[model samples]
Target: MATSELIYSVSELNREAKRLLASHFMTVRVEGEVSNFSAPSSGHWYFTLKDAQAQVRCAMFRGQQQRLGFRPGNGDRVIASAQVSLYEPRGDYQLVVEHLEQAGDGALRQAFEKLKTKLLNEGLFDESRKQPIPLIPRKIGVITSPSGAAIHDILTVLKRRFPVVPILIYPVAVQGESAKFEIQAALETANRRKDADVIILARGGGSLEDLWAFNEEIVARAIAGSHIPVISGIGHEVDFTIADFVADLRAPTPSAAAEHAVPNQAEWLGGFRFMENQLIEKLRRQLSQHRQRLNWLEKALQIQHPGERLQRNAQRLDELEQRLNKAMQLTLKQNQHRLTLGSQKLKQFQPIDKIAQHQQQLQYLQQRLQRAMDLKLVTLKRQQAGISQTLQAVSPLSTLERGYAIVQQHDTSKIVKAAADVALDTLIDTRLAKGRIVSQVKEIIRD
Candidate 1:
């Protein structure tokens, strides 16, 4: 079914095969015996790798051989880390090697890497997934060989740190193939018993094979699944295992793990003493505050007491009464002084004395008026006598005696000084000194 132009030549076929093999396969580890091993002066290694029934050509170039932990020779069992490919020039199937290690450790190293990558992918090695160790555990459980040095170190460290805390030991084999099962059962038993606040999975330093039991997947999973926090102190500081990676805390050694599990007694006692002093200080302040509040309340109650209020008001009333009496006395004294001044002014301008003086003056005026009247009467009498004597000298009565008569109108009693004074039809009186006569005129005559 192939096209003529699609056919591959010998060299082309080999090149095509190499490309296909390299693309289809990843880097792989092959464990077998080395045969026909040769190291050229060019620093290239060429060998044939075989098992009991199969063989394959292999090449470890100088670049890869630099990191080799051991020399590969004929009949030596080893592991080759290489790419599966065809040698293009020779048109042969071969392994292009990158590394070589002794098989004993090489297999375990491969298994360790495999399991490490698996648990890492599943997040068992994540810091966020790990639980925090308690500040002070009530009880500590240890899973290790009871007769081993690791248990002794753990117990000694724990006793020195905090001897009062109890310890529960689950004895197990930490080295053999059955060690993984024993450790896992101890973890489960500790959890079921619910007696430990924390558990320690510990072992002393050993070769990888000796430590293989701790690297089992069952033990790693047991640590990952524990409800209580676990501390793994497997091997020395330089040695690490799967249990260390999955545990909540990984200590360098068993003694260090024990140290991490508990707090010192003296330090805790010092902290408690400090707290007790603080509590006493707080109580004293509260008591002082309450006493001050009570005193304030007592004073307030006294201020509002009815008897106190009445007494204060009575004192105020007495003060006001005294002020009123003083004001009235001052007003009365001022009025008395004004009345006394008014009485003195009245005495200085009294009308009774004035009336008496006026009466005396009136009496004197009356006396003078009476004397004047008497003198006036006397003067008037003298004037009357003189007037009488003078009137007698000029009296017409003598002329009447000489026979002279005064003619007058008889009705009027008026003397007629001339004839013109008499009316013609009137009676006339002829007045002599002795008597008067009335005469009637018969005719008018102006003579």
Candidate 2:
């Protein structure tokens, strides 16, 4: 044993000590006042837990911090569930905090839960009781510390989005014993003034104890009773206070509250421009349709005019006259042929009595032919008159005389039978009872 003596470095000694402490006191629960609490960027909480006679260093890793129901601060008495360990690098004994809660705060948590349950049963958190945020507020009232960063953040956001809206500040203490009373007073004052269209109750991020003022029952009741809509922007996004539930609206931050209270000027202007464009397009379409209708009417008037009717009637009358002349000429030719045949027959007989008898017969036949021609001519004249009358009855011009008009395109001279056949601003002709009119289309109505 004397010959086996071994040398050890400082690191090796510390490692052995850490291994022994970790193995023996694997788990523990300690009670003490938290002090020198510090949280670094690595998300580890470093603190000293001290009693009247003894003190120990503690470290709560990020994983353990997540399990804490309430944040622990300096002077806060807490029960820490931890593991006994040693820092191998420093060779110092410590407790590795796995879970932590405020000393005797279990009762407070129970009370909070009970109150939350009671209020929920009473319907205080109903969505129907929540008020709508004004899209564009005339004035925004803020209830917070005058010197705090919450007020500055809110003002900055409002100025950026909508600078025209005025702001009213209701300064109040955001912490400590009198903080809840001060907050309630500010809320009442804002409502009494009735100047602000919307109100923002705001505070910066803080620990659970620091934000306890917002969890007061009086603050919640005051927010619910406010005539003006209240928006709660207390603490960080992860923190929820009683005031948040009773508020008309909830924002994650003070700056976000300002954003919810008013409309952005740029967005509103863009919307107005959009609506104006739509109205202009509608008017243009209406004008085009009206122009089409006017053209159609003008064409109808020109087509139905008395002048057009007269010209068409005259042309038809010429056709009738030509036909009558041809019919009379044919009849005359047939009678002339019959007379020549009879004369030939009488001449071939070569007898004086036959010639005299034939002459008398020819005279009588001539008289009878004359009578037949007169009767036939009368019949043909009557037929022609009747046909002319029928044509007049059915003529478009006649319809125009009876208070109708015909529509046609001036360019194509095509009849317009339906509204779809016409277009806006087209040159159209209309025939009336007396004259024709050429006009551009102004409007058209359809069913």
Candidate 3:
């Protein structure tokens, strides 16, 4: 008996089995229901594919999972394309999934995708269509179940931030089949009331099937058609629905929606205080400027007296007259000295021979003196005439003499310059050329 000494390691046996399965079933398609499907944190998916007879373990890497349009979950029927391979370490046979597609419910997913794409193409998710949430909403309308935590959170936030703001709650179903119509009706009611500044549509987190009401087309359309800005806070941070896309604003959580709807009271109070201070400061500055202007006006009025101005002018005129008189006296004295000197020189030049000549010169000088005096008198008289004419032009007495009587109110110092100033049946003082008369005005006439 020549038995061949044959030995093989476990790894070699498993490797040979894997190579045979990969070559034989390189691309085999199997239809089964997904069970325990889980995409681990390592970016690798582990699940079991089961049929009526048996079950098989499966692994789909991240690279292959990326190709899948939708995530597969438990109870999902899928057609998986994979290769039969053996794990070399454990020597266990498993299917390495390369591709997967929903088997029975693929049509529904396709319809959802189609509708989403159509709405997206129609610009339903456009940022420009979004409305800005009011920073300080005066009134907030809540559309949710009356007993839900969402309403509690919103009310608490609103009361804490701004207690004065009024909140109007329109309780509506947030789950189940009838929730959609209730939500739509609530939105319409809020719009009809026109009381709410902004509307908040909120609910707590739930499963996709539980939250199907928010994804309904009618609810989405209602949110889109609402005149008031709608904030969709339907589910958890990871959950999204049609309402989220159609709403004017989407909040990740119910608490976040409450925070977004109103401002903090402390912050608003701080800002208001700052503005009040600024207004007060501006008023103070204006008042100070007006006070300084009043002071300047008072000083100017004190220096603008007509009597004081006249007194200063009189003093200046007197000084000028005194200087003029002194100049005239000095000129007269010089002329007299020159005359005496000339007489003395004539007498010395001819003792008694020049007596006739000296007399003729004296006569000529006297005639010149007389002519100068006449010219000065004539100049003085002309000056006096000009002064008289100027005085007459401005004199009230001169005006009265020209048939225009000056009338003064008997009780007031003001003169009745116009007929309109004195009414009929009033006492008045009339000044004529000779004297003044107190009389009552009977009938005043104006031309």
Candidate 4:
């Protein structure tokens, strides 16, 4: 045996290394931060687990990834329970991760939290931005995978609870790499079509990676901007996505989404039956009350008799007539007494008796009238004597007897006794008390 010179090819050496590693470390738990974590199209995750000094390659198969609560991302510190193995083709040592947990702050969880905070600050997660789900949506648009169990669950619930509400499905990928874009496009289509009153974004329970499409910023914004109200029914009750925050309503399950969108037929029917019974009872009570009121009114009308009222009025009229006659008799007696008293007073002041008693006064008046006439005759005689005296005092004959004359200017009818009254040789008139003479001025005399 050539114990000193045994040779092996690279493939054989790699195979031998894999077998040795697998036998020594069948299962192990390692804690490190993930670097370059990636899930390719092959449904397998390849990543590097590194510490400060060293690093190791880790592989998670699709079956294990599906069972993980959260997806691993770059810089994620995690405790990975894996089988130590070597890649024959690549000639590298690696860890085949069977289970994993957050070692410290998970990279995926930190990213999720940071994005959530950013969206919240932008008002995308605000209650004011969230719309109200329709109580009775006429048409519901569902954005989900065509083959998912979520659709079937929602349809079954809606059909059983409210069959009248119509549902339209917009099929989209709910998992894997293309899921985010497909979900966003489905939401956009539902909005453009305007065919539905409300929209439902739903999926069955899955790992965080499987549910990542709902957490994408594009999908979250689409849900927030949709004119129709959105109900997020993604994953199980324990799982929450960003779409749940942005949607108008969040339902724990697909069935619960249907229940939230519309009211249950059985419950509605029960309420309607109760209301109907109450209405009927109220009507019966009202009718009975009205019937009682009618009977009372009939009894009251019987007590009001027109003939009796007229008879009572006539009795009152007769009593008033008797009182009026008594008043008239008393008035007549007072008038008679007043008339007798007035007659006695008239007898005391009778005009004929007064005339008879004043006969002497009448005689005195006559004597006074006679005296007045005699005095009038005497006063007339005195007045005639005074008139004679005044006529004697103003007599022109007396002046003529005194030899007085009056002269007048002939043309101007003015007295011409002075020389200035007339020019020389002017015509003049001279008058004695009894006569006048016409003369021409021959000489002037000064007085």
Write candidate 1's Cα lDDT for 15-114 as tens digits: 9899999999999999999999998899999999999899999998898877765687888789888999998888999999998877876668778988
Among all windows of ten consecutive residues in candidate 4, which has the lowest summed lDDT? 303-312
Tens digit per residue, CA lDDT, model 4, 289-404: 99999999987765554434445555655575567556655755675576567556657786576655555665675577557656755665565556555655565556666888
Question: Model 1: runs farther than 4 Å from truth?
Answer: 1-59, 62-99, 102-107, 127-129, 332-447
Question: How much lDDT does each candidate structure score?
Answer: 0.85, 0.85, 0.83, 0.83
lDDT of 4 at 96: 93
> Residue pairs in steric clash, candidate 3?
none
Question: All candidates' TM-scores?
Answer: 0.55, 0.56, 0.56, 0.49
Q: Regarding TM-score, does 3 or 4 come out ahead?
A: 3
Model 3, position 92, has a per-residue lDDT of 81
For candidate 2, the clash count comes to 25
Clashes of each: 0, 25, 0, 0
> Which lDDT tens digits does candidate 2 get at residues 1-447?
564586668898888888888888868999999999999999889999999999999999998777656778999888888999888888878999988866755545655666677777888789998888888888989999999999999999989989999999988999999999999898888888797989999999987778889888899889888889889999989988888888999999888888888888889999999999999999999999999999999999877865566567667767866776687678668867876786677578756677777678878977886787678668867765676677678877688999999889999999999888899999889989899999998998887
By TM-score rank, best first, the candidates go 3, 2, 1, 4
Off by over 4 Å in 3: 1-48, 51-53, 57-99, 102-114, 132-138, 301-304, 314-447
lDDT of 1 at 358: 57
| Pairs that collide, model 4 | none
Better of 2 and 3 by lDDT: 2
Question: Where in model 2 is the C-alpha error above 4 Å?
Answer: 1-101, 104-114, 303-308, 322-447
